[model samples]
Target: MALWSGRFTASANEFTQRFGASLPVDKRMYKQDIAGSKAHATMLSEQGIISHDDAEKICTGLDDIEREITKGTFPFDINDEDIHMSIEKQLIARIGEAGARLHTGRSRNDQVICDTRLYLKSRISNVMRANYQFSRVLEKLAHEKQHVIIPGYTHMQHAQPVYLAHHLLAYVWMLSRDFKRLHHSYEAADCNPLGAAALAGTTYPLDRQRTTDLLGFSAVCENSLDAVSDRDFVLDTLYACSVSAMHLSRLAEELIMWSTQEFGFIELSDTFSTGSSIMPQKKNPDFAELVRGKTGRTVGNLVSLLVTMKALPLAYNKDLQEDKQGVFDSLDTIYDCLTCMAGMISSMTIHEDAMERQAYTGHLAATDVADYLVKKGMAFRDAHRIVGHLVLLCEQRGCALTDLSLADFKAQSSLFEENVMHELDIPSIVRARNSRGGTGDKALAYQFNVVKDVLHQQEELLNALTRSVS
Candidate 1:
C-alpha cells in the first residue's frame, strides 16, 4: 500500500509503481530529508505539538538512520516511492507513533522543497570555495608572468600590445562575476519553505519561525501556495550554473587555441593532454576539449527545466518532479569541470618566447610609430596616412615596417627620424604604456597588487565561513 492508500480499494499496478517512483534519483536527498525532519521535530516540540520526549526519540532515530545510510547498512524499499516516504516509513517502523507524528503539520510538497533548498545552500557554498581556489591559481599565474608580452587584437587583426598578465586577469574578472551570480542564487535558496502544507497553510498551530531558525533559514516563505509550487530557486541556480559553464567553455576554447602549434602560446602537461593513435607526435589538449563540450549539457539542463515548468499550474504538480534531475546534473557537471580546469591551468607551461615572437610579427608597434610621427609636429591625420602608406610599402617589399631605413621612412614623411626605430620595438611599445590599467610594467605591477589584495580578502572570507560552518 502507498502512503496515501487509506481510502483506495486497490494498490497501484507494477507499471504505475515503477513510473511513479523517484527512489532511483532522489535517494541522494535522504540526508537532506533527515535534516529537515529533525528541524521540524524540534519545532513541534517547541510548539507543544509533540512531546519533548517524542522529539528526542525522533531525533535519535534520524541520527541512527543517517549512520546506517552512511555505512551502507540501511535497507531501501521500492514501495516507499521517494526518499521522504522511505525515511518516514523506516522511522515509523523503528519508533512507532512518534515517527508517524513527524509529519503532523507537514506535507511532502513543502518537505521536498525544504530539502532541495537545504541541499542547494550547501552545494553553492562548495562551488564558491572552488571558484576562489581557481581564482587564486589564476592570480599566481598572472604574477609569475607579469613581464611577458603579447599582442592584443581586434577583429583578428593586431591592435596593440598588452602584458600576458593583463590578458589572463580578464578571465579572472569574468569568473568573479560568475561568483556573484552563485551568491545571488544562494540567497534565493535561503528562505524556509517547510510550513506550507500542500497548497495551503495547515491549522495545526505550527510554529514556522521556530523551524526556520532551527534550519538556519534567513526567513520563512511568504505564501503557502507559492512556497509549495515555487521552483524558482532551482531555476536561478541552474541559470547561474549554465552561465558559469559558458564562461568555462570560453576559457577552454582559448586554451585549445593557445596549445596548438599555430598559436604556440602555451603547452599542456602530459597529464592534461592526450596522444593520437596514428600520429606519434600529436599532443592534444583533450581536457580543454572536454570542458568545452560539457558546456552544452549544462546549457541544455537549463533549457530543460525552463520548458518543464512553463505550462504547470499553481501549487505542486507531478511536473515539478522533473526539476531535480537537471539541477543535480548541472551542479555536478560544473563542479567537475571547474576542478579539471583549475588543474590544467595550474600545471600547463606558458611559452613566453613564442608569445613575444608572435607579438612582434603583426606590426603591433604601428600605433606607437604613428604616435611618434604625430609628436614630431606632423598633423595627426597626416601621420596616420603616412604610417598607412609605410605599411603598404613594407608589404610590397616583403619586409616589416620597422625594417625600413631612414631613407625609406623619409619617402613617406619628412617628419620621420631615427628615434622612430626605438618607438616601433615591441618591448618599448609595451613598456611605454605607463597609464593606470595599461600594459606597462608599472600598471601591471599595480594591477597585480590589486588582484593579490582581492585574493587575500577572498581567502580570509572563506576561512571565516569555514570556521562558522565547522
Candidate 2:
C-alpha cells in the first residue's frame, strides 16, 4: 500500500500507478528533496511541533538515504510516484515512527515546488557559467583577430568594411544579455516555498523563516497558494534558455555558411567536422548544423510549458508535473550547445586573405566614394546620386572605383578630388570610421576593454553563486 493509501479501501490500478508516476523525470532532484526534509524537520523541532529526539532521528535517517542515493545503492520503486515520496517512504522504513513525523506540517505540493526551486537555482548558475565560457571564447577570438578585415553585409549584400573582431563582439554582447536573463531566473528561484503546504497555510506552528535560512533561500514565499501554484521561475528559466539557444543558432548558421566553398571565410577544424560516407571529398560542418537544428527543441520546450500553465486555475495541479522535463531538457540542450559553440570558435581557422579579397571585391567602397564627395562640399543626396552613376559607369567599364581616371571622377561631379583615390583603399576606408562603437581600431580596443571588465564581474558573480549553493 502507498503512503496515502490509509484512507483508501482498494489499491490503485497498475497502469494508473505507473502513469501518474514522476519518479523517472524528477529523481535527479533527490539531494534537494533530502535537504528540504532535513530543514523542515529541524524547523518543526525548534517550533515545539515535534520532539527533538524525533527530529534528530529523522535528520539522521535522511542523511543515510542521501548517502545511499549518492552511492547508487538506494532502492527506488516507480510506485513511490516521485522523489519526495520515495525518499520519505524509505526514511520512514529506516527510522520507524520518527521518519513519518518529518512531514507533520508539510504537503507534497509545497515540498515538490521547494525542491524544484532549489534544483533550478543550482542549474541556473551552471547555465550562466556555460554562457560565460562561450562569451570568453568570443572575447578571445575578437582580441586575437582584431585586425582581420571582412566585408560587412546588410541584406546579404556588401555594405561596408568591418574588422572581424567587431563582428564577433556583436555575438558577445548578445550572450551578455543572455547572462543577465539567466541571473534574473536565478533570483526568481531563490525564494523558499516549503511552508506553503497544500495550497494553504498549515495550522501547526511552523517557522518558515527558519527553513528559508536553513535552505539558503533569500526569502520565503508570502502566500501559500501562490507559492505552490506559481511556476514563473520555470518559465523564466525556459525563456533564458530559449533566447540563448537562438543566439547560438545564429552563430552556427554563420559558421555553416562561412565554411562553404563559396565563402571560404573559415575552415572548421577536422575535429569538429565530419566527412560524408559517400563523397570522398566531403568535409561537413555537421556540429554547427546540429546546434542550429537543436534550437528548435529549446523553443518548443518554452512553448510547451507556456501552454501547460496557460489555462489551469492554479493553487496546485497535476499539470505542474509536466514542468521539469521540458526545463531539464532545454537546460541540458543549451549547455551542450554552448560548449560545442565554444569549441568551434576556439578551434576554427580564419582565412584572412580570403576575407580581405572578398572585402575589396563587391564595390564595397561605393559608400566611401559617396562620403568622399560629401567631404568635398557636394550636397549629400547629390553626392549619393553621383556615386551611384559612377558605380554604374565602373560596372559598364568592368573596372573598380579605384581604377577610374581622375577625368572619370570629375565627369561625375566637380567636387571629386584626388583625395577620392584614398577613400577607395579598403583599409583606409575601414580605418576612417573612428567614431565611438565603430569598427575602427580604436573603437575595437575600447570594446575589448569593456568585454574584459564585464567578464571579471561575471567571474565574481559565479564565485558568489558557487559559495551560496555550496
Candidate 3:
C-alpha cells in the first residue's frame, strides 16, 4: 500500500505508478531527503512534538539508510512513489513507530521542495567551481597568447587587429557575468522552505528557525503558500545554466571555425579531436561541435520548465515534479560542457604562423590607413571614401595596402606620405589602440590586472562556497 493509501481502496495501476513516481529521478536526492528528515525530527523533538528517544531512533535510522544508499545496498522501489515515501516506508519498518512519527508536522509538498533547495545549494556550488576552473584555463591561455596578434572581425570581415589574449578575455568577461548569475542562483536556493508544511502553517509548535539553523539555510521562507509552491530558484538555476551554455556555444562555434583548413587559426590536439572512421586523414573538432549542439538542450530545459509552470495554480501541484529532471540535465550538461571547453581550450595549439599570415592579408590595415589620413587633417568622411577606393584598388592590383608605394598613396590625396605606410604595419596598428579596454598593450595590461584580481576573488569564493558540499 502507498503512504496515503488509508483513504483509498486500491493501489494505482502499475503504469500509472511508474508514470507518477519520482523516486527514479529524485533518488539522486536521497542524501538531501534524509538530511531534511533528520532536521525535521530534531526540531520535532526539541519542540516536544516527538520524544527525544523517538528523534534519536529516527536520526540513527536515517544515518543507516544513508550509508546503505551510498553503498548501493539500499532497495529502491518505484511504486513507493517518491524518495520521501520510499525512505519513510523503509524507515518505519526499520525503526518501528518512531520512523512513522517523523512526518508528523510535514507534508511531501514542503518536504520535496526543501530537499530540492538543499540539494541545489550544494550542486550550485559545484557548478560555480567548474565554471571558475574553466575561467582559470582561459586566464592561463590569455597569459600565454598575449602577444599573438590576430585579425579582429566584424560581419565576418576583418576590421582591425587584436591580440589573441584580448579575444580570449572577452569570453572570460562573459563568464564573469555568468558567475554572478550562478551565484544569484545559489542565493535563491539557500532559503529554508521546510516547515511550510503543505501550503499552511502547522498546528503543532514548530521551530522553523531551528530547522533553518540545523540545515544551514540562510533564512526561512516567510509565506507558507509561497514556500511550498515556489519554483523561482529552479528557474534561476536553469536561466543561469542556459546563459552560460550559450556563451560556451559561441566559443565552440569559433573553435569549429578556427580549426578548419580554410581558417587554420588553431589545431585541436588529437586528444580532444575525433577522426572519422572512413576518412583516414580527418581530425575533426567534434567535441566542440558537441558543445555547440548540446547548448540547444540546455536552453530547451529552461523553456520547458517555464512552459510547464505557466498555467499551474499552486500551493502544490504534480506539475512541480517536472522540475528536477530539467534542472538536473542542465546542471550535468553545463558541467560537462565546461569540462570539455576547458580541456579543448587548454590543449589546442595556436598556429602563430597561420594566424600571422592571415592577419597580414585581408586589407586588415584599411581602417588604420584611414586613421592615418584623418591625422593628416583630411575630413574623416573624405578619408573613409579615399580608403574605400584604395581598398578597391588593392583588390584590383592583387597587392596589399602596405605594398602600394607612396606614389599610389599621393595619387589618392597629397596628404598621404611615407608615414602613412607605418599604419599598414599590423603590430603598429594594434599598438596604437591604447584607449581603455582597447586591444593595445597598455590597455591589455590594465584589463589583465583587473581580470587577475577578479579571478583570484572567484577562486577564493569558490573555495568558501564548496567547503560544505564535498
The runs of at least 3 residues in candidate 1 whose Cα sits more than 4 Å from the true structure, single-residue gaps closed, are 374-382, 467-470
Model 3: per-residue lDDT, tens digit, 197-247? 999979999999999988888899999999999999999999999999999
Each candidate's TM vs. the true structure? 0.95, 0.98, 0.98
Candidate 1's error at 422, in angstroms?
A: 2.1
- Residue 87, model 3, lDDT: 96
Query: What would the TM-score be for candidate 2 when compared with the true structure?
Result: 0.98
- The residue-by-residue lDDT of candidate 2 on 229-264, one tens digit each, is 999999999999999999999999999999999999
Candidate 2: residue pairs that collide: none
Error of 1 at 65 (Å): 0.7
TM-score-based ranking? 3, 2, 1
- Cα-lDDT of candidate 1: 0.88
Minimal lDDT window, size 10, model 3: 461-470
Candidate number of the best lDDT: 2
Query: Model 3: residues >4 Å from true position, as ranges?
Result: 468-470
